[model samples]
Target chain A: MKTINLAESTVRDLNQALHDQAIECTEREWEVLEPKGQHNIACGLDQNISVDIKGPTGYFCAGMNKKAHITIHGNAGQGVAENMMSGSVRVKGNASQAAGATAHGGLLVIEGDAGARCGISMKGVDIVVKGSVGHMSCFMGQAGSLVVCGDAGDALGDSLYETHIYVKGEVKSLGADCIAKEMRDEHIEELSELLNRAGVDEDVTAFKRYGTARQLYNFKVDNTAAY
Target chain B: MCGIVGLYLKNKALENQLGELFEPMLIAMTDRGPDSAGFAIYGDEVPEGSIKLTLRHANEDYDWAGLAGKLKHELNVGVEWFNNSKVAIFKIATSDGIAEAFITENAPDVLILSAGQSIEILKEVGLPVNIAKTFNLKGMKGSHIIGHTRMATESAVTMEGSHPFSTGMDLCLVHNGSLSNHNRLRQELQREGIVFETENDSEVAAGYLTWRLKQGDTLNEALTNSLKDLDGFFTFTVGTRDGFAVMRDPIACKPAVMAETDDYVAMASEYQALTTLPGIENAKIWEPEAATIYVWERSSETGVK
Candidate 1:
């Protein structure tokens, strides 16, 4: 395993090394040390490799990632794994707002709680949080699924679209158009697969599904009050 | 976008190093906000019934020394003043209302930055690093400090528009993010007899908190009220006489991270600001939940925990 110390190496050097190895088709395991909660660490990686960050990271860590498996041992700042495509980002600790925001296709997992808007405007990214999520966790989500193991804050899945939400705990409130839906066999199977992928063990039967009511999908005049 | 940094030392051992720890944190956010910077430091509690006011004037040559003598003679009270460029802080044995009224009537051009027993606010339009040096912020010692670097999305870049806005005694607020309904809220607050010093949306938020506190709401309750009443994307870190608090808007588009240890509790718009803090690696770091009030007060009533 190759090790890079953020205190000694610049972010550019780290990214360049990762990019070079990815382009060369050299599979390498990398470890980042002394990250010290720096911003933009391991961002914009397009490698099919594994990178473990020893400490917390600031905004946009692993942003725009593609085909990389990034793990943060400590908490992450805002927008961790944002806009990711075809990769997995895991945070052992909590994540700040907008985690995995606007991502197209990837799996993001948070072992601890997540701040607001965890999957805001998300498209096709699957998110699994083992702990509670703050308000508006799935605001305007377009596709994929959000699985929460703990209670959800107010306005969960506000104005959601297409995305499926499975919460094992109580939801403080739901946003416009986002309503609890039936959890069928297919949904339970999907949630079980996601939980398994995130390495979380929980009974699929304990979760409730939430999705858009489809009433405001066409922007009818009757829904003006909701807007 | 803007950057905010707050450091509240739970252990009195870290009091003297408040500025030393906060300076690097504030400067780390230079990329987020470069237009202006400001800070509110809490320390040196004045005697009972006395107040401290930090004031500023547009004219660099404004005679702060002369104003101190005049205030002493006119108010018939003891007044001590410290001048820094366009800013001057006054300590007077008088009520906050009386001193504020005196300044309003006598020195109409001087803008009051803060008035409290323990808070001293210094802010100006410049890069965060430059502003820190200009105010000699690294040399100031306090129990807790809150700082802001503003990019000026809602208002022009001026000292008045800069953050760490103080609308209540020993209370100051620094915000990151713009308010969507500031104009309407400002009008509402104005109608309720709350005066504003700037057109900045953050000032309205500060005024709202001050108004709520005046109505007998605790700081935590006031922050809770803000979540329902204020409309916008905001991450606020507020400093008070006894402690500091943090709250994020429900949507919470703006970023905020907090770290707590046995010795101190620190908050920043980004975790990078906290990297330089002592014992940060072992600190219990987490992202503050949306619309939740996280308060840390020095246990004065019942000794330190």
Candidate 2:
């Protein structure tokens, strides 16, 4: 196990050390101490290692991760694990806005509530929140799946495309062209697999699925006045 | 991108260390706003019928004593003042408009940053660390404080453009986002007798709140009404005589994090600012919801009201 103290070394040094693992794979497990809510800790790691961040973090913590399993012991600031390509990131506490934003791939499991824009513009990421999510959770989501065990705020999946959304609790209001869809066997199986991956113990059959209505996918002259 | 930080002490024992606890929170936001920095601290309440005014002059050698002497000789009012650098605090026993008018008429160059029973605002165009040091922020004691570091998006980086804009008695505001409809709103407020000091959009926000408060609205009421009337993205931390309040716009593009401990309630634009506070690890921290008003007051039985 490799230990890095943020109090003693800079975030650059920490990230550089983590990035170095891709070149030469010696140490596989890393522990970060005293994160002190600094931005960009353990970000942009391409190696397949496990990192445990021991404290709360500021913006963009573990952002743009390609292949790394990172776990935050405390709350994460804005855009945590944003734009990740692969691997998994787990936040033990609440996450601020835009968690897993625009990530192409990965599994993000937030044990606590997530702030607004939880998985905005995500391409292929699978996010499961054990607690509620704030408004505008998955705006313009192109792909991926968002699972909310608790209540969801307004505009769950606005202007979405090919993204699957499952919620066990109340959704405040759906966005334009977003509506509740049938929960089929395949969806339940998919949601079950996602919940199992996120380590969440919940009844998959009790969830409702929502997706794009496919109304605004193409421009229509009849809707030109609304535009 | 501006930075806003506020500390409201719930425990009376922590009052004396308000500045000491708040300085690091302000300095931590240096990267967010490096053009200018300012803070409004609420403490040292004057007796009834008296007000404290924080005055700033362009020249550091501006004789504050002479100004006080002139006011004492002309207005026949007792004036006690404390001067530091180009800023001075004048405590005078007078009515609402007399002292402020006299100072403006007598000394046009001297800008009255704040006038209230308990509020003193210090702000300048510089780094947050240097501004905090210049104001001796670490040694001063207060019950509550609201600070701002500005990266000046909507206006020039002038002292007048700095935040913690005071528009009402014992009430000041520091903002982290830009106001879009300030020009039209400023015209409407000016027509309603609300005074504006600068072209900055944040001052317009302060003026709008002052107008609402003048209409017999409480601090929380005024902030709630601002959501409907004010346009643009903003996360504001307001300082009153009793305590402080935090409000974010409905859009809430700008960030705001709040933490509440047994000792104090701290708020900043980012979580990093609260990291330096004592017992922060155990504090109940959360992001304040959009278009919501969170107020903490000493007079209230419960800290949040």
By lDDT, who's the top model here?
2
- Report the lDDT tens digits of candidate 1 across residue range A89-159: 99999888889999998899999998888899999999999998888888999998999999998899888
lDDT of residue B302 for candidate 1? 28
Report the poorest 10 consecutive residues by lDDT, candidate 2 chain B. B296-305
lDDT (10s digit) by residue, model 2, range B1-305: 99999998888898889889999999999999999999999899899998899999999999999999988889889899998778999999885678899989989999999999999999999999999999899998988999999999888889999988996899999999888899999999999998887799999999998999999998888998999999899999999898888899997889999998888888999999999899999999999988988888887736455
> What ranges in model 2 sit over 4 Å off?
A221-227, B301-305
- C-alpha local distance difference test of each model: 0.89, 0.93
Tell me how far the alpha carbon of residue B126 in candidate 2 is from the true structure, in angstroms, after superposition. 0.6
Model 1's i-RMS, to one decimal, reads 1.4
- Chain B TM-score of candidate number 1: 0.96
lDDT of 2 by residue, A163-219 (tens): 899999999999878899999899989999999999999998889999999998898
Task: Name the 10 consecutive residues with the lowest summed lDDT in model 2 chain A.
Answer: A218-227
